[model samples]
Target: MNAQSPKTVDDTRLDSVIYQDGIMRISYTLTKTSKDEIDSDAFTKDKKALAASVSCDEKGLGQFVKSGLLIKYTINDSSSAPITDFQIGKSDCL
Candidate 1:
């Protein structure tokens, strides 16, 4: 499931993906950016885009969404310290 992990997404690296407790957690690490450098409000607004993709995608997270699982996106700084966590669920798609 994580064959494509360690992938780079924009300014961050998607480190890994884990599923447990009805949640699918996608972890990312900043490559050239830092926690302090992120604007929380703008970063959070990005969740709408993520939600849209999940709802419209047929080949990616469609199956997961159908399962009604909570999808979580977590960010960590370059120092391996957690920065922020965002969660999207079935309701988010609607």
Candidate 2:
């Protein structure tokens, strides 16, 4: 796995969507894997990055945690137009 950050991070490479409830849903496909890596940790980090991508108040973010979803992946400017900062946590759908 190339542990280096790409020069140009493509939003398409990192697609995230914010629902009406303010929970940001993010997904990614890992290009590399390690035997020691845990799936849950990877997912959590990605979710945090997604949360960082948005611009929301800590209080607003609290709602996500209260709701059980935790932000994992956060990439600022994940899209063409600047979108609102989002939070990620546990989701029943997932």
Candidate 3:
């Protein structure tokens, strides 16, 4: 899936993609800021919208969601330290 990895998508840079335990894990590094720069409260508040975007997607992500694939997004800081992560599953969408 990560044919062109380590690429920048907006402000985040996709580092790698892995699959294990029926989950597609995508790791991204925020190129613009550090973990401390991100507001935790705002990130938490946007969880639902993020999950919905994945759930309601029609292109290809939704297909993965429907097929019971747990999609995980792991964001790291510019220093390569993990900031926060979340998973979008079928149950999360519902």
- How far is 62's C-alpha from truth in model 3 (Å)? 1.2
The digit string of per-residue lDDT tens for model 2 on 1-83 reads 12432333432344444344544454343323332343545655665565544423455555455556554443333233222
| lDDT, candidate 1, 15-48, per-residue tens | 9999998888888888876778877678767855
In terms of lDDT, the poorest run of 10 residues in model 2 is 75-84
Model 2 alpha-carbon miss at residue 6, Å? 14
TM-scores for all predictions: 0.75, 0.27, 0.80
By lDDT rank, best first, the candidates go 3, 1, 2
After TM-score superposition, the amount by which residue 3's alpha carbon in candidate 2 deviates from its true location, in angstroms, is 27
Q: Write the per-residue lDDT of candidate 3 for residues 5-35, one digit (tens) a residue.
A: 9889788898889999888888888887877
TM-score of model 1 (CA atoms): 0.75
- Give me the displacement of residue 35 in model 1, in angstroms: 1.5
Between prediction 1 and prediction 2, the one with superior TM-score is 1
RMSD of each: 2.5, 11.3, 2.1
Q: Best by lDDT, which number?
A: 3
lDDT of each: 0.76, 0.42, 0.78
TM-score for predicted model 2 compared with the true structure: 0.27
Q: Score residue 33 of candidate 2 by CA lDDT.
A: 32
Best by TM-score: 3
What lDDT is reached at residue 54 by model 3?
59
